[model samples]
Target: MPPGGRQVLGADLGVVDHAACAGEEPELFFHGDPGAIALAKRICGRCPVREACLARSIANDERYGVFGGLTADERQELQGRRAAA
Candidate 1:
């Protein structure tokens, strides 16, 4: 819900417990470099709440950074594919 796909929440916020990216650098998610993106995706690939993260990303119309392992363009293509399907 914050910029760069990074959220700063207290332990009381349950999302903290399940978000594998919670403590990762926000820049890691927002950087435009290909290597950074790959790393971000790898992190998301193992995340327990990947689908939830993607759903939230699409729901919020996130236009930047990596969310649920997909880049914004990748997410857009995924949406297009779903529509076509």
Candidate 2:
């Protein structure tokens, strides 16, 4: 996938889209501080593929960075909810 998670055409199938973060600087998502996490979440909040991104992160068990506008703690909570259901 290209940087910034832009959609790409599959060689013999439908269009494939990447996460919005793919286009952004890697540091923006990986910064290990509260302010950086907040900024990254703000960016993700406006992403068109926020749901997909979050779902992918959760399914993949991502251990760091922001995805789908949520922090690691938030994702963990969500995972808990999913397990409860």
Candidate 3:
């Protein structure tokens, strides 16, 4: 069983489960206010699978919402860094 009550295939194949934000409202991550972004980052900072979440978001080119404590712009910057490396 994967996170968020969903059974993802290859759970035993090194797939990282992401359930830390399952119970959080979607608005918390997508809001434009800095306070909301900070709250979302705080929640993400405590997540065990934060790295995996960010990796996935980056790989998928996520254009909105906060993932792994980073906003879209942050992720874009990270992508740029990765590309530059």
Residue pairs clashing, model 3: none
User: On residues 1-85, what C-alpha lDDT tens digit does candidate 3 reach at each position?
Assistant: 3333343232331434444777789799999999999999999998777877777677667799998889999999988898899
RMSD (Cα, Å) for all candidates, in order, is: 5.1, 5.7, 5.0
Model 1 lDDT, full chain set: 0.82
Kindly report which residue pairs in candidate 1 clash with one another: none
Candidate 3 wrongly placed segments (more than 4 Å): 1-18
Better of 2 and 3 by lDDT: 3
Tell me the tens digit of each residue's lDDT in model 1 across 1-85: 3653444332123454587898799899999999999999999998887877887778778999999899999999999999999
The stretch of ten residues in a row with the least summed lDDT in candidate 2 is 7-16
List lDDT for all candidates, in order.
0.82, 0.72, 0.77
TM-score for each predicted model, relative to the true structure: 0.81, 0.72, 0.76
Count clashing residue pairs per candidate: 0, 4, 0
Rank all candidate structures by their lDDT, best first, as comma-separated numbers: 1, 3, 2
Question: Could you arrange the candidates by TM-score from highest to lowest?
Answer: 1, 3, 2
lDDT of 2 at 82: 86
Give the top-scoring candidate (TM-score): 1
Candidate with the larger TM-score of 1 and 3: 1
lDDT of 2: 0.72
> Candidate 3 has what TM-score?
0.76
